[model samples]
Target: MANQEPRVLIAYGSKYGSTKEIAVHIGEVLNKAGCATTVCPAGEAATDLSAYDAAVLGGGLYAGRWHRDAVRLAHRARRSLRKRPVWLFSSGPLDPSASEREIPPVRGVRRIADRLDAEGHITFGGRLDESARGRIARMIVKSGKGGDFRDFGQITGWAQTIARDVAARTGASRGT
Candidate 1:
């Protein structure tokens, strides 16, 4: 068979559960692609790196920052990540009229990426729920500019690409 299914760990830091859903979806996509995938909340510091061959990390962005837990996971895994493939993603920018941007300018994020030699970093549009937000976020949603902005097509496409790359790496390592 293939090379042990190329274990992949998908960790996410989510607020109001959006980012967690995204991470789970990525795991599903990768699993369908024949990769063994594990999905977890980054805050848990769960998913031991020894069990995975590659990793993808994501978080919900608030005020130009990735969730603290997500940053912590990246740092915690830095040494192990250096020996494997790594990818990063952030969900942000609630305004539909706004130009969508991926990847926040957080120093911790960039530092982790550099340490791990990340494979890719993506930014995705986010979901804004008035009921789930605070005064400011709720006010912003009330201003007639809030909804789920995540692009599934783009997310899935990226996951598929990762599937290909991870599969290749595993196969190569197995001498396939």
Candidate 2:
């Protein structure tokens, strides 16, 4: 085999596009770490898994469920992914309470992680802007269940960690 760095795919499903940005950030981090990376919508990507050595899947959570495409991709690639490294993430949970307690665990990502033997799973705070929300989303915001709660720092930190892990894996595999 050629001594090329492993390829990393950051596939994401975004409703209002926040998750897409997060995936882009991850791709940037991986690229800086010397891996060939691609960031794309999960539904739009080719389903063949043989080309990637590592994968990161991200999505938006709506009413306790991940975007459909994310779920479908994970399910479709489950068998093949079991023999490789995979990471899962969701962008959701905007709690405005003053307490600094961690956001409650999302059952969907956990279930997917268990099924795929994912290296790690994460849930980040989501955003809610009444002006940008749709009818139902606006109603939910008006109902007192929404706020802008995204933490860019935490998201970037997580991406950094993932970069390091991917770099380490590629280095080890290449005996560098």
Candidate 3:
């Protein structure tokens, strides 16, 4: 793969579109770092990872559990994932705590990361708004607990690190 740009797939499972936005940002960062990236919802993600050199799987968190679609995708693509570098991320914290500290993956997410032998995992702040669906979401938003807490700077830095790691391993030149 020398001098070849790394192909990265970023798959996300989002209920209210917040997590999807984060996934897209990561894709943009990777792309700017010279990685060829594909971003898509986990449900719509391809089961085959053969076309990509690296993978990033992320999901929205609810009740301390990862989105069902993201979990299912991990299971479906476990074999392919193990053959390459994999990363995991979760977005669910309602406060700025995630931005202030390193929030570990929830239990189920940790297990999935372990199973996939992921290179890293991160938990970004979540977003809930009046437009969010579900009674609980609406309640949270109405109760004055809804807002976007994601830190794009952190997300971009993390993605850039991934890009550097991939480029180092593949011997590919990074974009200026």
lDDT of 2 at 35: 72
Worst 10 residues of 2 by lDDT: 96-105
lDDT of 3 by residue, 91-172 (tens): 9999999999999899899999999999999999999988898999999999999999999999999999999998887788
Query: Backbone clashes per model, in order?
Result: 1, 0, 0
**Clashing residue pairs, backbone N/CA/C < 3 A, model 3:** none
| Per-residue alpha-carbon lDDT of candidate 2 for residues 1-176, written as tens digits (9 for 90 to 100) | 24577788899998877788788888876776667888999998666777888899988899889998998888887887777789888887767331245554478778889998899887877766676457888887888877777677777777778767766766634321
User: Model 2: which residue pairs collide?
Assistant: none
Order of candidates by TM-score, top first? 3, 1, 2
Collision pairs in model 1: 102-123
Query: By TM-score, who's the top model here?
Result: 3
1 or 2, which is superior by lDDT?
A: 1
* Index of the highest-lDDT prediction: 3
> What TM-score would each prediction reach against the true structure?
0.88, 0.84, 0.97
After superposing candidate 2 on the true structure, give the runs of residues whose Cα lies further than 4 Å from its correct spot.
Answer: 1-3, 96-105, 131-133, 143-147, 172-176
Q: Candidate 1 or 2, higher TM-score?
A: 1
TM-score, candidate 3, is: 0.97
Q: Global lDDT of each model?
A: 0.80, 0.78, 0.94
